[model samples]
Target: MGVDIGLEKFLATSDGVLVKPPQFFKTLQGKLKSLQRRLSRKQKRSKNYEKQRLKVARLHHKIDNRRKDFHFKQAHALCDAGDLVFMEDLDYRVSAKGMFGKHLLDAAFGQFRTIVKYVCWKRGKFFAEVDARGTSQKCPECGGEVKKDLSVRIHDCPHCGYKTDRDVADGQNIRNRGIKLMSTVGQTGMETACADELPGVGLTLPRQVSQPRKGKTRKPKK
Candidate 1:
């Protein structure tokens, strides 16, 4: 299976399934903003201030946990079903341009990709990062040029009359590239790609990420 990572829907598979965006921060915006306003109004050194600060921090933590859980579920389900999953190797630094770019960066696609890669290795499944340069512009069905703005959400190939969801078309291109890469490399190539690309995931087992944090220490009752 091949996948496209996008902000609208978290991921769009080549097979037409879309993992919907969680919009974690968006959902919590009102509560967080209210807490922030209340936090700002408090006396800096007061106990009430600290209490409100903790409440705000706790809300942030909740958002993070929910986001992580959503990503993990998607990764696990994809790895379970796919033999070799393909995805674009995105550069957040480059992609994070313009006013709202910081928001895009916070999506943490890099971290999600890392987790998915590690899981694939553990399960003895294949995963490849394909070049994303023209995957979206070129038509996967007919190899026809169908350049489009980000606003376009559907791919209508004038040449081959192939119509598909835009992100799904990108996923198809990613899958095709991965297949071509595997064909060129053969079994040895696949092994080399797995070892070289992931670097230590296959050798060093992945650690659990949900360990509990210890509370503040306290003196004995005296």
Candidate 2:
């Protein structure tokens, strides 16, 4: 399942390897410092000044490309290996603000999903977006809700007494949502409901196909 990176509680308890996200800022900061030195030495608007400016811009361009490449590779690796992916669908506009905002935005959680989605589509896999609003606070076992401040790392569910690594709970909650969703569609026995959503709760099987095909007409009886 897809889990948002940065939720330390979930990652710590998760069953897989944790690779620290690459730092593009470190690379950009170095490029900017060098550019500043060159700009300081050049006369404003002069031909040489413009050339140096373009060089700096080119470096920035390359750095951006590299950052995207890394994110895609990591995200693709996660998405490709799993039959289904569950990840937080964060409100980037609101969540990505302030000092760490740019860094968080740079993580481009949204972009990661987009890339993962296209790849999943190509491979006939399933991709699901878990709502982030209460995922971190809800108990996976008994649907208990807990109010927690950001500093509270442990997910202590008062109602159900279910305790877990917060991120793991969120991940499990995400997985549970996928299960509930399948149940809902399956209950109705409506092919449309189950057709697109990820299928086979927790098994990572692709969603069942529904709806009749088009583009070819049946011939009259011989």
TM-score of each: 0.80, 0.71
Residue range 4-49, candidate 1, lDDT tens digits? 9888777888888888777788888899999999999999989999
- After TM-score superposition, the amount by which residue 145's alpha carbon in candidate 2 deviates from its true location, in angstroms, is 1.8
Q: Give the alpha carbon lDDT tens digit for every residue of 23-96 in model 2.
A: 57665786788887998899998999999998888877877788778766766676556777766666666767
Q: Any residue pairs clashing in model 2, and if so which?
A: 2-86, 10-167, 10-168
Error of 2 at 202 (Å): 37
Itemize residue pairs with steric clashes in candidate 1.
none
Worst 10 residues of 1 by lDDT: 203-212
